[model samples]
Target: MANLNLTQNGNFSSLAPIIPAAGDDNGRSTLIFLGTGCSSAVPNAMCLIQPSDPPCAVCSQSLFVPPEKNPNYRCNTSLLIDYCQSDANRSYILIDVGKTFREQVLRWFTLYKIPRVDSIVLTHEHADAVLGLDDIRAVQPFSPSNDIDPTPIYLTEFAMESLAVKFPYLVQKKLKEGQEVRRVAQLEWKIIEGNHEKSFVASGLKFVPLPVIHGEDYICLGFLFGEKCRVAYISDVSRFPASIEYVISKDGVGQVDLLILDTLYKTGSHNVHLCLPQTLEALKRIRPKQALLIGMTHQFDHHKDNEFLAEWSKREGIQVQLAHDGLRVPIDL
Candidate 1:
């Protein structure tokens, strides 16, 4: 393990190269943070405040600093789960292909050299989460062996219907007698009932969808990936149900190894997203071994936020931190 260093600019000084452990190297998995911003993303064009009007220093600094220097200057929220088989073959499971999907995917390829995405699991059908569906064409022919086989996509029926309406070309593939075939994103849609009554398997991975309320009328899914690596990702949650609490906790004790939660604002509440106060209350209940806050807005300054969280964690004796783009956490499988 390398010493973790925080730089003055509020980003990790350096990311240690991921190396497979010696012996007992059957398989390994890693969680990659592709983006950690809210729907409008950090440094939102409309929210840019100048220096004189009680300005937002975070967003203001983002205007001048390069993205390589500030990891908090983020796109929309999304995650990449990278799994390496014993044979050294690599596969990826993506969560939420957002508006910045193409940029994030290209960054992943340039930074980590990942070549293919095995599957995509959508959290909901919100534009910020699903608008990137068309960009999958960049990685067409997902599998090396089968060019025609579409990449598997797992989501709720509601989301499936939404995609069918939004991207008809990708969802419904048809041919005409005299028409030439057009190349589009090939996708295999799998519908999972997200009532929290059942679990689904995708590419040998088991996922339990924990239904959460996303405002007044919409329902969102927070997934729990089962196996040696226990992770619960609830990025757009406003309410956490008791049923999900039972699934993630062991006898009222938190058993989730990692809890990736949504904390969209520094303060105050929103009808659809979790604010800091609400997130802290939920954190106290979940009691996860480690928690990473995501779905942030430009109001959050990485340095300032971590400084507050560091003191809070010291007083509370719980390990929690804010997530940033390009951050990666390795999981033993």
Candidate 2:
């Protein structure tokens, strides 16, 4: 159940829309919803709701959200942000290359015609979020003739330490003087640069790191992009701080246009992730024109969940959408 009391009459005129590279020349920014399902994406233990049951009722006519327990439900975690090819300096900045990185990269290359990834901004060091790092080798130049080269992988100093601990082979020094693996070679590391609090530009986009509590043992990051269109990707966040809220609402540089938040637990309470009710409460504070919930787990049937959310959002005057693999959202800037 969601509390939908979003204000629609506010002046968004001060905020310029994100224009995707496609369509009109007004410079609209585009957001492609890739990998909406949470870590236990379809077919996983949590998502495969109808292993033996019939098709989903709501998603029967049109397969918008994944049907209850459909085997086709994919991975829950993944996302890529492409700054349309407007500015010459604009390059593709990837957020959290999940276990499905190879698949996501191929899809992006085919759909967006991207030959090279400019940079990768990691959200955390979770396995599902960073496992696909090996796949970056595919995009690196294999031949000298190839023009585009390997992209830099960016992370916080703490995250890099965590990655080294988790994937020691990738970070291990040459044991016997043998050549390093091609995958390891593709990795060019850069620390997320800036004073701890202020916003900084890494890759091509302006990124502001909003540190949030993830669990007892670790801290997680949610990023705010651009001056007008603020996308706070807070997947594992348990609570929202006043500073975070102020940045997204009337107090900061601009109003949040889109919030891609985590809705992992709908009914239960996780010490780390934000529950559905909690997410809705945050929405009231930020009041973005549109909000998309990501990192969905199997407990939520896509269609039923979305239908419920849509109806609820309408009542609250907030526009909302559940993200999915290959779902392209264009923002007009």
Winning model by lDDT: 1
TM-score of each: 0.88, 0.78
Candidate 2 lDDT over residue span 50-145, tens digit each: 333565332342346433223235554666666754473446667777777776666556766666667888878887788887766677667533
RMSD of each: 4.1, 6.1
Worst 10 residues of 2 by lDDT: 6-15
Off by over 4 Å in 2: 1-28, 46-72, 85-90, 143-150, 172-185, 193-196, 251-254
What would the per-residue lDDT of candidate 1 be over residues 77-195, giving only the tens digit for each residue?
A: 99988876567666788999999999888776568677778899999999889999888878776443335778899999999998889988778666567765677778899999996
What is the lDDT for 146 in model 1?
Answer: 33
| Candidate 1 error regions (>4 Å) | 1-27, 49-55, 86-88, 142-147, 176-180, 250-254
Top TM-score: which candidate number?
A: 1
Clashes of each: 0, 28
